[model samples]
Target chain A: MAATRALIRRGARDLRLLAVPQCGIQADMLIGAGCVRGIEAAAVTMGELGGAPRFNAAVKAGAIEIRDSTCPAIHTALQASEKGVPFMPLRGILGTDILAHRPDWKVQDNPFAESGDPIVLLPAIRPDIALFHAPRADRAGNVWIGRRRELVTMAHAAARTLVTVEEIVEDDLLADEATAAGTLPGLYVSGVAEAPMGALPLALTEHYGADTDHLGEYARLARSAEGFAEYLQRHVLAQDVAA
Target chain B: MPVTRTELLIATIARLLEGCGHVAVGASSPIPGAGAFLARALGGDEMRVSVLGSRRHNFFTDGGRELFDCAAQGRMDAFFLGGGQIDGEGNINLVGVGDYPTLDVRWPGSFGSAYLYFLVPRVILFREEHSPRVLVPTVDFVSAPGVSEEGVWRRGGPHALLTGRCLFAFDRAARRFRLESAHPGESAESVAEATGFGYDAADPVPETAAPDRRMLDLIRGRVRDEIAETYPAFAAEVLGTAA
Candidate 1:
């Protein structure tokens, strides 16, 4: 998350962010600080901290383009890219308004089915870059993501993948059979940065819980444009100087 | 028995979820999530409830893709969705109000709402704020249409809409919503006044059932604790549980 923030701070403009719901503080921060120009995800919220104030404010102000996506659509799109497919046929979404809004999405008659039912076809999503925070990484760039396999999919689907981790272990993650299943091979990792507490305010699963009080404060402070600027200046910008 | 509006809404939703083998509640939906948990507790081991972001409640190992895959395969029986604006015809607008591309009010884009609404057999549209402003005549943008075109291969759509003022059952045949019952201290007339769209109302509408002592006990006890794992502040504020 911090690694992505650094990219945004370096004026990576008009970048599209893809993330799972409840894990999009970096995206929110990018949008709030005027870095992101578009986003594609299922949902983006503070998760018990309250609503996503910055994201919501940005949307209300019409400052960014958003592709309202669901978990499956994103996964399917990435899967299509991973498999080198132009599009993937999905079972549901024929009746959804989601299909209506997405001009790129198409409905086609089931080519193999006898019922002649329609199916939703989602285009492949090959992002320019995928950035995330992991629990640990090795010197060889193998990131140990544990059960967060979505990171692997993001790496496979995106042109490049960057990650921040708590620590850099000397041991080969793949040498341990138990850990190999959870490791994203260094082949897919573009860069690795060491940033302990990178996913603060958001949890790193077994490592530490989210800073709910701080997130609550963020939610409250980001409710208005002025407050949001103050929040960005205090938390993100100030933290940049300290880092 | 005295029942708060939140309890009544939960109880009403629980009743709507009767006999479902599995129910999936999305993020930021504490009421439905709690209700599903209550139903699971009442129904015993056979019942499965997956609340997104909850380690104890969710069984998905592959991240966000699992839920959509489960729903598509007919493994999920019920789900809940909310929108910024829901029309009489069951069309939900999660994308902002007014024109698209450049809008007067831009909401967080429509997530996988339309997709799930098409596959999940029992999609309950839920919103706490039931006013004319929200329950509009026609949604400015349809994030998910209430009914699909004939032969669109849709197996699931909206079953009912639960709100603070009343309960509305969706008629797939008519593609319109009908007032089922009103909450205590609210009448059909009040619901009509609050709703922007026309609906078929039952003559002499009954008051929505209150949560009984047993149900209330489960809600405030086990259900509250389980939901708190995913929605800490909501569980604390709504159910008086420790975060």
Candidate 2:
């Protein structure tokens, strides 16, 4: 709670919650409650985001606004914002349509330190704040990634980060030879919460449901020509300023 | 002699790999891994091959953490996937229940398909069963858009489809799937019978081969063992508890 409060204070107006493609529920909760005005997600377009019932309903009811960010990589790039590097290089997205509007997603000529090969480059991404769900965290904020390495890159790239985990353990968990290394080290993570099943709308391991039915509803609503307009009216338009 | 359903499925995948130049298979993707391994064991070593485990979110490499990064870098020529809902356009929705908020059911969701579908040059889709549940005229959601609304993808579309009883290829010119082949035991009539939409009977139908011993060896030996070591949960889920 302290972490969330501190993050909210730091964000003020400049804060934008950058979520991975998987952070569906967290986005839903924040957007639903009006804590955040807009969201940026990879793979899914803004049009797609507005289609979610919770998001769309919020949009329709005048609760929140939404935006689309392209590719999971771009979202990761934005998470990289804290690193201060201009960009990062990634493969397989080179020739796709995602490259057109994402001017930030540049292709650099490979310096090829080994052989001088001509390969494209991607820009580094660092976000102002990154919120992720994890299995465990220490009081100091070092985290265990376990099998899910979803947000490790973002940790290195983000200016600040907060993790909501299933449990908060001692720093010695990192000391055990059998234990996993610091996926998101205490140095990178500013705050930690023992928030299990925090990754809603999407599954956070076995503890929660993915809320797929809601996603289906969003899909149906998003596909209609006037769905976006209607959704915005119902979810984003009617909210009275929190009195 | 008619090939058993499992054999036929495996054989078709093996056949697809016969002369492919380069390929990458994903974890828990039984068909793709079996096919690629069979192709190599059968003297298609000239084709560069890699079996990438984990999703766009869970990237892994043998060289510890140094070589592994979550993003897919470089050009990927081919990939295979199977999911819950796929439409005529080949758009797939692995993210939800048929409906939202109050969903009928939930799936594991699209781990990497959304990104891989757009990035890979050729994507081969396979499913064990063909019916209204899996094959629909239109997808319920857009986990990955078959044809980007803006025509954004450069090299790949949903290039080809291999189902239990039929084969389909996306005619980029037409921007629709064209019937390419039907399994030996499955006549055009049977394949069409299972599909939600109708197609021309005159479409050229290719013959599907029976799963040979070599293909079985690939599954029992290389693919299954590797999966057991790398992704134990997935192997247990797909191969059953005894396996």
Candidate 3:
């Protein structure tokens, strides 16, 4: 989230943010700050912060293009990209209005199945950059996300991957058999930056829990544009002074 | 015995989840999560629950991908979904209140509701607020349709819609909601007044039953403790359980 705040502060624009629900504070922050032009993901929520106030406001104002999606669709699209496939066939979306709104998605008769049932096919998602914050990273740039394997998929599917970590560990993550399974090889990682408490207000598994009070404050302050700007000024802008 | 509205909803949902082998509850769904936990406790060790954000409750090792894979393979039996606006045809609007691109109100984008609504055998649509505005005649946007075209292969859809006023069972064949029963102190007429959509009601609709002593005991004790691990505030506020 800190990295994303920096990105917004630096005036990154026209970014397409993709992430699963309740785990997209960066996306919500970006949208709220007008740094994002499009979003493709399941949902963007602040967990106990009530909702993504800025993202919700922007959507209502028609300031951003939203590709309303599900977690599986995003995962499948990433999987398709990982496998170098043009599209991936999924079974669950045939009757839903998701297919109706997503003109890019298509329904086709299953040629492989004897039943001749219709299936939904989702185009691969190859993002320009996949950015995330992790608990730790090695000197070699391999990130130790532990059970958070979605980061690996994101790194694999995107053209470039940028990461921020709480600390740069001295040991190689891949050297330990137990940690190797959870490590994302440096090959997929394009850049690494050290940013402690990067996922603050959003919990990093095994590291720390979300700061509910701060998140609740953010939810309250982000209800309107002025409130959101105030939040940005107080939290994001005041960071340097606090540091 | 006197029962709270929150307890009533949880107990009602538990009854709805009678024989589900595996139930998955999303984040910010304390009622459904508690209900699933209660059902699991009552139904024995056969039942399994995967609540997002809980390390103990969630069994997914590969993050978001496993949930979808399980659902597609028909391994998951039940799931819960909510909408900003739900229509007579079982269409849910989670994107916003008004037309697309621009809207009067915007909730979070559709999470995985569209995908899970099609794959899970029994998808319980829930909303604590039951008003004409929420229970609309037609959703402004169709995040997920209740039924599909003839050739579309859909294994699952809406099983029931549970609101603060009553429970409405969805008939996939008719593509309409049928009034099952009204909550205590709520009459069919009162429900009708509150609801914008038309639903078929029984000649003498009975009042929803209160939670049995056993269910209440379980919910207040074990279920509350279990849910607190994921939703501490909800458990604290609703169940009066210390976080």
Candidate 4:
């Protein structure tokens, strides 16, 4: 969430974000920073940590616009953008209030089927930027996300993809066939920044576990706006990368 | 061994999943995850459980959309869902209470229920809280409807709902819930008093079975250990794995 920190440092605001299916502290931190004006995607929770305080508070206060959605819908929309399609048809969501709320999402008869085969169609989600943190990237900027192909799809669908890596490896990430399959080609990458421990307080699969002690503390502090602002001032803004 | 409430819930989940080939659990579902693990341990090679966030548990390589795709193709047999508000008709509200766009309270929003509820045959609704506020007469919003219209091409929907107080089995033909069993110490009158939604109850609601000694042992040992990998805090709290 270095990009989130950078935005906070630069005092960015009124941005829209997708939880990319599910979001936690990263999204909460941004929401608490008052950077997000709207959000589109599935649930916002701290997972095992606890409630996403800022998100809950924002929604309660009517501070931000919530585009209520399910997980597959978010992915289906991204897939439409990846394929350069206007929209993608998906099963389920019939008679749901979620469909009632989503104005852009449509329900139509499937042309492939006979009569009465209705489906939910989601408009493509081509984001202006897709930012995420990874374990490492090569000099070519090829980032190995292992089997987390959601990042690959995000890069493919977005206008620009920015990556923050723990380190820049000397070896070519895509040169090896095993790593090649999991590597996001630098061609899709707009920029790469090396920020060690960038995923601090958040787990970086195979690299490090989340600092749950720190996260637990954040969970406690983020319960109130003042406490959250204090967290922002102390941990996010004032603290350096190492701290 | 004395069975804790957590152990009882885990065993109940495992028993409910008896015939399933594969069960995929979503975020913040430790009890379900542990129960799935116990099922796999008992049911052997054919039974698969993918605890979504865990690399140690989940076997999918295609990323976030894989679970949805797997369900669409009839590969996934079951899933568990919970809600901020669940009504008598089986509709769940994951969005929030009060008016849309200006809610008095907001949840994290629907995760995969919009799609998964249709694709996975054994869609079990599990909520530990069995309060009138949560078990409502009618949900303020439908994150996913309990039952779709006859014409809608839905493969599956609410099979049953498990709560802290009791279990309610959904009859698709009737489009209503029938009280199955009440948890130990909870009677039909108690469940009714706590529940806002009216449901057909048997003359004498049977007590939900306690966890078998073997099952309790497995939960305290193998299941707890497995769950600790992903939900450490939960394991520590429920399973007492802190040591």
- Using Cα atoms, each model's DockQ against the true complex is 0.48, 0.10, 0.67, 0.80
Q: Please provide, for model 4 over B174-235, each residue's C-alpha lDDT reduced to its tens digit, 9 standing for 90 to 100.
A: 88899989988899889989999878888778999888777877888888899998888889
Best-to-worst TM-score order: 4, 3, 1, 2
Give candidate 2 regions above 4 Å deviation. Answer: A1-19, A23-152, A156-159, A163-187, A192-243, B1-3, B19-22, B25-28, B40-73, B82-85, B93-115, B132-134, B137-153, B197-207, B230-243
Q: Which predicted model would earn the best lDDT?
A: 4
lDDT (C-alpha, whole model) for all candidates: 0.82, 0.57, 0.85, 0.88
Segments of candidate 4 deviating more than 4 angstroms: A240-243, B240-243
Residue A105 error, candidate 4, Å: 0.7
lDDT of 1 by residue, B177-229 (tens): 88889988999888988999998988999988888888998888888898888
Top model number, TM-score: 4
Worst 10 residues of 4 chain B by lDDT: B1-10
Angstrom error of the Cα, residue A204, model 1: value is 2.0
User: How far in Å is the alpha carbon of B102 misplaced in model 3?
Assistant: 0.9
TM-score of chain A as modeled in candidate 3: 0.95
Cα lDDT of model 2 by residue, A10-117, tens digit: 443423565564344344434433467665554222222332444545444444433333345554454445456666555434433334434555655466545433
DockQ of candidate model 3? 0.67
Residue B179 Cα positional deviation in candidate 1, in Å, after optimal superposition? 2.2
For candidate 1, list the clashing residue pairs, or say none.
A70-B112, A97-B144
Worst 10 residues of 3 chain A by lDDT: A19-28
